[model samples]
Structure formats: structure tokens, C-alpha cells
Target: MQETKPQAVSRATDEELLALGRDVLTIEAEAVVALAGRLDGSFVAATRMILGATGRVIVTGVGKSGHIGRKLAATFASTGTPAYFVHAAEAAHGDLGMITAADVVIALSNSGTTAEVLTIAPLIKRHGARLIAITGNPSSALAKLADVHLDATIEREACPLNLAPTASTTAALALGDALAVALLDARGFGPDDFARSHPGGALGRRLLTRVSDVMRTGERIPRVAESASFAEALLEVTRGGMGMTAIVTPDNHAIGIFTDGDLRRLLGAQTDFRGLAVAEVMHRNPRSIAPDALAAEAAATMERARINQILVVDESGLLVGALNTHDLMDAKVI
Candidate 1:
């Protein structure tokens, strides 16, 4: 049969278009806000169940809800909770075997009556796994079958036709985020843990990288004794490729530092390099950082001090390593 042509419709005015856009946003935002008040014992129970689960969280849904479930599963996994998304329809086709008694199943369906999701609910129960349902109608079959029902009921859809999933999906996503954050806090998932999960991301590099990992150590460090001549310090700086040299006492404790900037001031004064010792011309109490500090912290210190290089010291205040802004750049920690 030939497809019927869509009826010609009148174009909306600019004002009408703007009003519709604003209405959609306002409705969705209000739906999310109202979901906050609806949190009750069921919310708490869902959180505790997932937290106590020995296996991963299996999130399942169909259509738009499936898309949201994928995102929720990712959030849970990245935040220290092990989780994976399984299409609700696929669960009835052998995927249900993936569910174990140790795992927790979180199913999403706005009406609490999605046929595919409902079909797999019994198998999840038979596996002895706890079921958490996020749906709008708690009186529906899916809600009644769940071990914990999270009420995601909304006043209405943000869609103009009220047919497409809109406000309901937004509420479901927000509820998923809420659950993930609560579980993250309870498990004490910190920045380091987050970094470990995202090693290739910028935040991961900032959090997991340490001063020791990037700082130049041992022979790579530029150092000279306090008694060394200014010429010798310059040679050490050039050899180490750091543009500066640390002046250390006989006990190997850094007493000061001399940089290219200091040389300029000496040159302007016409000071005789032959008569000057590094100890006399070097800057006293130079800024330093601990080797155990985060590379990001070192970057912050350098930015605040307006300096390019920093000395890495041990607990005893002895110089162990050194690094400059260039090292941070190479490490991608800057």
C-alpha cells in the first residue's frame, strides 16, 4: 500500500516556538525536582541491596529506558560498583542465565508493564537475585514483582504529544545517578580509585601521578657543593639540562639554588664570576616539594610561585630529585 501523506500543518510563530521550548525544559526540571521528594524506604532499600551484592549489578530495560540503563551501568562501574547493561528483551533469550544469586538486577520500565522486561522478571527471581524496579506505576506487575520498587512516577511527559518518553526518562536517569552517588560514598570510593578506573583521562593523570614518578632523580639532578665555584654550578646546570643547580652542604642537604635568572642579575652588576662562590650568589630557602605529593599539587605550587623548577626533598629535607614545568608538560600533568 502507498504511504499516506502527512497532513500539512501551520507553522508556529517564533514566540510560540520559544514558549514550547521553555515549557519542555520547565516540565522536565520540575519532574526531576519532584522525584527528590518521592525518595522513601524503597530508595534506601535499593541502595543497601546493591551495596551488599557480592556480584555485579545487571541493569536491563527496553527502548529509551535501555539507553538510560546503559549510562547507569557505566556510572555504577566507574564509581566502584561493578555493573553491566543487558537488554531486557535479550534477557529472555538465554541472557537470563547470566544472572546469579549473588548479583542484583535493576530493571527500568515507565509503565511497570513492558512485556519483554516482565518476561525476564521471573527468571531473575528464580536465580534468587534481588530485583530493584524503577517504574512510574507501582501497581503494575513489574513493580509488584520487584524486591524493591523505586517509585519514578512523574506528573506528565515533557513531550508535546505526551507519547514519547521525556520527563519520565529524565527522572529515571536522575534516580540512577542518585543511587550511584550514594553507593560511591558508602564504599569510600575516592579520587585515587576514580583515577585508577580512568587512567587515560586528564583527571586520572592528575590524581594518580606523583612527584616521584616525574621528577628527575640521582644522576639526572643538577647539584653542586656550597663551596663550588659559580662556573662549576653553571656547568652542572648545563649538563643536567635543568637551567638551574642546587647548592648543597657537605651532608647533602640543599641550602640554596642558582638559576639562569640569577646569572642575569650578576651580569648586570658586572660581578667577577671568578671570585664568587655558588653559596654567596644562590637564593636561600628555595621552594621545594615532597616526592610523595601529587604531580598536580606540584603544578599548582609552580604556578603560584611563578617558577619553572622545583626541588623534591625527602622527609629529612635532603634533596632527592628535581623537576621543571617541562617535565610536567611531558607527563601531561600540567
Candidate 2:
């Protein structure tokens, strides 16, 4: 008999590889859309249960589900819900004591039969804490034991081998987001509330920070009497370190403001700084903000007016403080 060579399988072309990528995305997207349709009264009940709980939400899971649980817990905490993550394996070893009757436990398990989670399920029930399950299999033991089961099932895995968790994990994460947003809406959690939870971030600065927090007060405020010479105003501006000085009335109300830019304009007119009064070259009705206004609002006002500095005034129109763009930047409110 004559020897024969075996035929080799052809490799995928660039077009074929691109098509495969699109197919994976399409599968995952469809899986998420399907979860939306699967949502029912159970989801509403779960949201209510979370809202009604007097204590924090305890999230637990294993493997990839555990990773998702951490993010879910963080999202919950950041969005007005008191929540924290507990590793399922650790729960089996004595972490179950963390669960109290005041808490509601959310367990993530794609198979709904994860051994580590199953080990602690009954203990949670005994503690009088309600159990909410997010799982791909509604008929799984975890779902059957849950007070409310959220269906995160998908028709197929995005992985070609049908072994890895791709579409299922995406569905579970989307479902978690849906639940958190629903709770957020029900509780009327606004930007101000969100800012309180994020004091060190930009969003916090924009919403929680006030002009009074970043403005220069006391002797740091650059100011001069309206009758003072421009040379005196220049000295005040230099001492204040701000680019401008406020020309104030005898009662300390700001009548006008003089800036370095004003000096350039004055030089254009061949005027001597010592010969002019502070009021002569000052800008009347200069842009001013209230000390209580949000720092973000101040930044916006400066941007719209195309100015670098703004005066902070009290309700009496007195110059109580002053700030420049640099101050706002340093405060991280710009």
C-alpha cells in the first residue's frame, strides 16, 4: 500500500477572526438583553427587601462570582446602601458570625450549587437574615433556598468550548447594576448624597465643596480704599498674592476691582500708577460669587465670564473673600 500524507486544517483568515470577535460581543449583548426580559416581580421584591432592611447588605460568592460580588458590594455602598463583601470560603470558617438579623445576604453563584456557598446557606437562614440569590440556574439549590431569586440565565456561553463563564457573568453584573440603580432611584439618592460618599474625589469637590472652603479670607483678601492710589492697590495685590485687588467703600463693600490686566491698559494710556486713584482704573460691578455657592459653580461662572479671578461677597455685598483660578485648581474643584 502507498503511504499518504494527512491533510492539515486551514487557519482562519483576518476577516474570519474579526467576525468571531463580533460574534462573541453579539452573544454577550443578547444574553444581557434576555436578562432584562426575565426580570419580574422577584426583582421588585428583592429591591424592596434591600430597602427595608435595617442593617447592611452582605454579599458572598466564590471564584469569578466572588469578584463580581466585591464590585456589587462597592456599588451598593457608594450608592447609599450600606453593604460589604464576605468571601464564601471564609464564611464557612467562621465569617458567618458577621451576618445579623438586621442584614440581607446576597449570594452570587452561577451554578447555584457552589459547595462553599451551600455550606453557609442554612446558617444565614438561621440568623433570620433574608437570602437573595443571583444565579444562572433558577432551579438550582441556592435559588430554591433563596427568599428571592434573580434569574441571570443565558442561552449559551460566549466561550466556544461552553466551559468558561462569559455571557453568564455579564448577565449577573448587569442584573446587579439594575438592582442597585433601582434602589438608588427608590431612595432619591441625588448627586449631593453621592458626593458625601466620595469626599476625596472630583465629584465630591464639585458638589460638596463651597466657595468659602477655597477662598482667601481675612488679611489674605487683596483690597484698598477707593480713594487710595493705584500704587497702594498694586502693593495690596502683591501682598495678597492674587492677581487683583478690590477697591472698597468706607463700609468695606466692593465698589470695583483692579487687576494686572488693568495695569497694562493704564500703561497703554501713558498714566503713572502713583498719579491715578484706585477707583479711576477699576472695573465696576466686577464678577462676584457668594461665599456659600458651590466651588464648581464658581469655576463655571469664571469660565463663562472669561475671567481668572472672582470676589466672594456676603449678602451685604461686602468683600468677605477672594479667589483666583489657581486657588480653585489647588482645591481640585476646577
Off by over 4 Å in 1: 1-26, 261-274
Can you write out model 1's per-residue Cα lDDT over 196-299, one digit (the tens) per residue?
Answer: 89988788899899999999999999999999988899899899898899989888898899998888899999998876788889999899999999999999
lDDT of each: 0.94, 0.93
lDDT of 2 by residue, 1-334 (tens): 9889899976999899899889899999999999888899999999999999999999999999999999999999999998999999999999998999999999999999999999899889999999999999999999999999999999999888988988988888899999999999999999889988998878888889999999999889999998998789989989888889998999999989999888888789888655878887899998999999999999999999999999999999999999999999999887
Best by TM-score: 1
Worst 10 residues of 1 by lDDT: 271-280
lDDT for model 2, on a 0 to 1 scale?
Answer: 0.93
Q: RMSD, each candidate, Å?
A: 3.5, 5.8
Error of 1 at 24 (Å): 4.4
Tell me how many residue pairs clash in candidate 1: 0
- Error at 49, model 2, angstroms: 0.8
The runs of at least 3 residues in candidate 2 whose Cα sits more than 4 Å from the true structure, single-residue gaps closed, are: 1-30, 201-208, 228-239, 262-281
